[model samples]
Target chain A: MNIIISNTAGTPIYEQIKEQIKAAIFRGELKEGELLPSIRRLARDLRISVITTMRAYNDLEQEGFVVNMQGKGCYVQSQNADLLREHKLREVEKHLHASVVAARLCELSDDELLNMLKYFMNEEDEYE
Target chain B: MNNILELNGVFKSYKTFALEDITFALPRGFVMGFIGPNGAGKTTTIKLILNMLQRNAGTIKVFGKDNIFYEQEIKEKIGVVMDNTFYVDEWSLKDIERTLKPFYKRWDSGKYNSFLSDFRLDVNKKVKEISRGMKMKLMIAIALSHEADLLILDEPTSGLDAVARNELMEILSEFIEDENKGVLFSTHVTPDLEKIADYITVINNGRILYSGIKDDLLEKYVIIRGGLDVLDDEFKTKIIGCREHNVGFDGLIDSSVLPLLPKNIITERSNLDEIIVRFNNWRENK
Candidate 1:
């Protein structure tokens, strides 16, 4: 519900919408069966094309994050054990992609980057 | 009902100006903003759609029917608001209502009264006596009361203050809730469209520069700024609307080229105004 969209983002608007909805589900911010704004309402609020919003919702449904009900609207899907695991792994994959890009940009060696990551992981464990 | 309005390869000519192969579509349940610089033929296109001016070539379709063939049928479903008042100057708000009510088959008196009250228009005030903003509100009230499927407005917000403009936009967003309705509004105010329009068609010098999803158009271009030292032939050749100042040179470039640019260059998503201005510069420079 605390969605914020940036007009200037490099990602297309529909992709942004799908990502946010997925994030909300993964973070448990959106409960199972919680109703989402109808496609037209969301499009109106965001001042975007209804077609774009429909695409986002369709993608979310395909990814098993939401379900669209005839005449009722879209709702968050109840989390499945396998789907949750896959979703978490996908999130990690995104960060891994970013990390790879950063490592390449900074010319970091594998050893140095692995050591840095391990050191940060230990630092976080100590705090916990 | 798939496309509320469609114009394909449409053309018109005058002694000094011509509209050439203009094409765009407004699907049902969306708002399309028609924008351009002055004398860009926005009004002419609106006139063509209204059948006031005849097109020399191509076709116009409204509600999936040929516009010229179904002129009267199409006109009945269209609610029009022009930049200038077309009502008699001496006619009161009630008088104007009385005159137009007989023309539409589905005119609703209750809905009409509600619109007048909602717009805070005085029934006794003559057309000439009202403020520009009030007059526009009157037009909008009348347009909505007829239960038209499409609203075609030309410069409907030209003179209104910020608050009035916002009110008008809010009303438009509400109007599209029916899903069977659509709006094609022409304006120089690109910012307003950015807030409510689903699609945008930008015209300049009687040519269509871009026409499609609003987000895609914004995504296609980027505005970049950097110190004048980096302004070289490579940058110069790629930029649109390039402007040099004492401190820096700034202009627009295709978003795809952003990754290839030097690191010192700052980039932001180009806005509608920036896009139009840069397009005009690029055309003139070419």
Candidate 2:
């Protein structure tokens, strides 16, 4: 899989690598059982620190999107369909969280916030 | 965790300058950027590690043995690339290698010859005849040929151009492909370190201001900028080496204080260069 990093993205480089790999996995570009590039090789190719790639791989492993085999290498996990759905669900939950904070800032009542959510749903439905 | 090199409370003194409480460790399988402004005891610290200079107090260990005790054993395994070479200036590359080859047990002539060709250095050229970048590459070639586990570089990238520096990074990344090898690279060129260094140890006036993972250190500090009017005493307290002008003021501050900043203030992530400069500025301000 090809991964590009942008220093100007305002996010840390390691996060960019992690998110890109996660996106690649979700897109089925990285198939299950496909071995990822060795951490040092990736760092060398990308001209980034070995630790940065190590961090990204470690994080992916911890998050269950990747698995490490001792002395073997990292590989994309099996059963990615449920994992993919779980990731998208987390994103939706995060946006809803931000919406709640924004609604609280505006001092909107619970009913008003619920009505706004309904309005958005209907708008999206009409577009569909 | 195995440490290739460790220094604790390593103190050294001269007539007017001194290094105190110099402590840091380079773990195996990574690179540590040894950074500081000029005359900040970086070279002195390296010298102490190499046993070229004596420390007044504290301990230094290389490969789990006291540095002084294992000086020869450690020297064989630790490659040193100082800003200048000590090889006879008139000696050709081949002659130089021939002179130094006997000192190393695992001197691979084939590897040395290939690296010289890869660097495009003529084997017949005298040591003083090559460019600075070539000289740097030659040192690295020698370092690698001897199968050194730890590479200590002092200002190795000083005179090299950006392309040369990037090439050096590639070579260094390849060098540490083995998990047992490590590097302690000292340079004023912070951007080079930013790309390849796993950890950073920032020293100033012979003291370590910060020493830890490079990412964490970068994440810890931020650049704060705002109009001079925003420079209240409370806000100023959080800033380091605050530079004030009629129009605005800017300085480095811990990211933890970002929440306390007002809406008018601007915050940006601090890079290694900015951090080092602001630190030196802080010294001047003090």
Candidate 3:
């Protein structure tokens, strides 16, 4: 796995690792039933604490994105269609919320921003 | 077995110096950084744990047994690499290993020889013939040669170059792969600890300031900087190490107070080195 830890991002190191791994799983870069690197080896390679990586793996397991087996290692859980859809929808809502706030700051009306988004959506089809 | 080493109310006193209420625990299968400035009791705390200096009070346990009461059994499973060497100057690398092998039941000559080769030390060179970094590496080689359950290293990377320091970090990561083993590494090289330490125990003025998870400690404080005009007495009281000059003001503040600050002031996450330096500034602020 290719992972780069950022020092200036303000988030804790473990959280950064957890988020990146979660994103990879969601994007299908990591396959279901595929083993993640052993916690110790990953730490050695990344030059990070083992506890930090262990926490990242544990958080993934807690959210049902992975399963950890004793003596073996962590394996990615197969994606649930409905669960992933809900997660993606929530992510879209978060982005739209930020867009609305930015539009308000620029004094753009709600309908104007909605129309802009619709135009952008149609603009993508020509390229495809 | 949760904690490999524990110190409860450990105190030591001298004519002009003392360590007060020193209490912390190194959890199993983790590296705990014992950090403090010079004369801040970092070395004294390590000495107490190793039973090198007598503590005026409190109990210390190594692997669940009292360090003093079961010194022999405890020492066998503990590997120590301090700043000073205890070997004769005339002893070569081979002679030193031979003399120390019988002390550890789990000593492996294969591991010793391999480490010596990896560290690029000549076995024929006497202790006085090598440089400071080499001597430190030799000490670490011996420490690793014995399969000790607990490794207590005091500033092992200070004199070493960046390459050697990186090597030590890798070696330590592999060593802690076993859940039964742990390390209590005491050093002011906070950057090294930032990369590999699971827990951080900060000492200042001979007292424990913070002891817990490394992330929690880093998340606790933030570096605040702004114009000198922003330095009001009320806000200054909340900061641990407040300072001001003609140009601007800067200090360490608890994150809980971050939201209360004005928009003009900016805050950033603090690192281990900044935390240690700011901790010393706390007394002056008072």
Q: Whose TM-score is greatest here?
A: 2
What would the TM-scores of all predictions be?
A: 0.89, 0.92, 0.91
Pairs with backbone N, CA or C atoms under 3 Å apart (clashes), candidate 2: none
DockQ of each: 0.36, 0.52, 0.54
True-vs-predicted CA distance for residue B77, candidate 1, Å: 0.7
Cα lDDT tens digits for candidate 3, B162-275: 877887887888888777889999898888889889999998889899998887788889898999777888988888777788899888989987878876777788899989
Candidate 2 lDDT by residue in tens digits, B1-286: 7999999999999999999999999899999999988999999999999989999999999988899988888888988899988888999999988998999998999999998999999999999899888889999999998999999999999988988888888889888888899999999889888978999999999999999999999999999889987789988878888889889999999998787787667778889999999989988877
Model 2 has a DockQ score of 0.52
The Cα error of candidate 1 at residue A51, in Å, is: 3.8
> If the candidates were sorted by their TM-score against the true structure, best first, what order would they fall in?
2, 3, 1
Each candidate structure's count of clashing pairs: 0, 0, 0
Alpha-carbon local distance difference test for all models? 0.88, 0.91, 0.87
How many residue pairs of model 2 clash at the backbone? Answer: 0
Candidate 2 ranges with C-alpha deviation above 4 Å: A80-82, A93-128
Arranged by DockQ with the best first, the candidates are: 3, 2, 1
Local accuracy of candidate 1 as per-residue lDDT tens digits, B1-286: 3999999999999999999998999999989999988899999999999889999998999999999899888877899988788999999999988999999888888888899898888899899999888888888888888888999999999988999888888788788866899999999888888857888999999989889988778888989999988888977999999988999989999888888887778778678899888888888989
